[model samples]
Target: MAALTLALDAMGGDNGPSIVIEALARALEQFPQHHFIVVGDDAELAELLAAKKLSNHPRVTVKHASQTVEMTDKPGYSLRAKPDSSMRVALDLVANDEAAACVSAGNTGALMTKAYFALKTLPGVLRPALMSAIPQASGKSAFVLDLGANPVCDSDTLFQFGVMGAVAAREVLGIERPRIALLNMGEEDIKGNDVVKSTAQLFQQSQLLNYIGFIEGDDLFADKADVIVCDGFVGNIALKSCEGLADLLLSNIRSNINAHWLTRWFVKLFYHRLQRSWDWLKPDHYNGASLIGLRGVVIKSHGDANTDAFFSAIQQAVEETQQDLPARIRDRVESVLLEQD
Candidate 1:
């Protein structure tokens, strides 16, 4: 792939610019074809980059922002008061077409607010929903969207999410005719409240999407649906629950592996294979969530992400940018809107 430009919110995460700088260094090595712009307090970012021997790297640029977005800041406050924040500056690079995408491990609400403001929603999109891929049982990936981006979505918005999710799966994950399902209490068409039932009706009416009715929480990773759509309220909880379950499984597996000498010896013998399994289950492996339905690509990383997790976020930005995700979404949304009209 050709070299793509990305902006990094150096001062956004809890661990400071140190982790972001370190991740950039790692990403530079792994993706030698990419260019990166690091946005933050110029002095501090320069110092950190120098420490990592990336101060004068050919593909790296440092941009100065006067402020940082605190984790506790409200979305409205951060959007209104901190225009020069690292988060906002990084987002500006994307808006100005200086960067293909921006990755920020900042406050989710603030990031969403600023990103939606800076990038604007794609035509016909009611809101820019956040989406992240989840590993599936068939070793494929399923996408879940509205991940805390829009807490209260109406039927129209939910229907739009399903369309966007399908387009995302088809473009980004190479899933043709991606099966779309609404996340609900039960799998039956009659299981949900009015909002969900109404959303399902819209999906069923659409010929552009592969509407597969509803799926319960248990089917999240069952590969039953290629695209899972829900409001931010339910989607965020589902995402967190998956992460928590992964942690729990890892913890229990480790505990059992060391509980007996035979088990320990067996693990040691198959350590490499077991390590692959562990790596697959690590939540850090999938740390970036895309703010979809926008005119530009924006990736929201976990606020407390470490170097590896942050690097994964950068990787996601690159992947989405390379796939031209926003354009695909824009085109699909236009198509869906025309279908509705």
Candidate 2:
């Protein structure tokens, strides 16, 4: 049997080679069948592997990439000036079929730009959208698309996002006939701007999607909608705001616990319970965000991701590759477009 090869950009992210090496080690132990090609300086990667006592792993290999695309570099400039950068090299591996998937914790904008230009989007997909799952109250996750792809989107683009997001929810969340909702300021038909109103009409008229009504920002965590569709501008704001709120809430809870002797004693009494709750709320649980509608599977991790976060992203890429998520999405999106015509 052929081994599943995953190309990783070792020089990307804030933690650099150390996090990549640690992630590689954890992934190797967890999924022995998946091989990795670390694209970066061969000597540095080798040293990191040796430090982790993972240099002798049979499934691991190193590919030398001399250039590094800095986070501050423009996407177009980086792609043109540094063809041999780790990010470019990793995508090239996928483009040439040398690897099944590409995973990176690099600049989010650069990754999306590189993936779209290098690997290309699937037929009928106007632009690729970034999709991530946000945890809800019912132990279920809601899919939000265009998280940071296109800041401005047309109704047609939003309609396409709805179709793609629905297919993703079905494949990843095992939800059949996933309920779709348009993200708006109000639930009323006349509440939003021209875009939202037009989108609502489009969804209402379509038979292909299970169009639930409009959903406000508060509906995100209420489990009122399963699949939330919005333009990248709105989606990105919502995503970042949610992250900030989570951080603030966690900090406040910790501060309160440590403020009083009685509360600190109470926390000690239920330390395991408190710890479990905190663990459940950690961002690492949802580390991978797919650049959906592309021709291949590309997962983008947080720029400041650690070893565990990188490993989680790799695991997501493995699952997506094994499931042929891009192909599945292509089929669904094309079918929807055909029905409309």
Tell me the TM-score of each prediction against the true structure.
Answer: 0.93, 0.94
| Residue-level lDDT tens digits of model 2 in 226-284 | 78999999999987887777778777888988999998989867655766665445543
Query: Candidate 1, residues 143-250: lDDT per residue as tens digits?
Result: 889889899999999999998999889988898899999999998877988999999989989888889889999998899999999999998888787778777877
Find the number of clashing residue pairs for candidate 1: 0
Question: In model 1, which regions exceed 4 Å deviation?
Answer: 254-279, 282-285
Q: Which regions in candidate 2 have their CA more than 4 angstroms from the true location?
A: 267-286
- How far off is model 2, as Cα RMSD? 2.0
RMSDs, each prediction? 2.1, 2.0
Give Cα distance to truth, residue 289, candidate 1, Å.
0.6
For residue 177, give model 1's deviation from the true position in Å.
1.2
* Each prediction's whole-model lDDT (CA): 0.89, 0.86
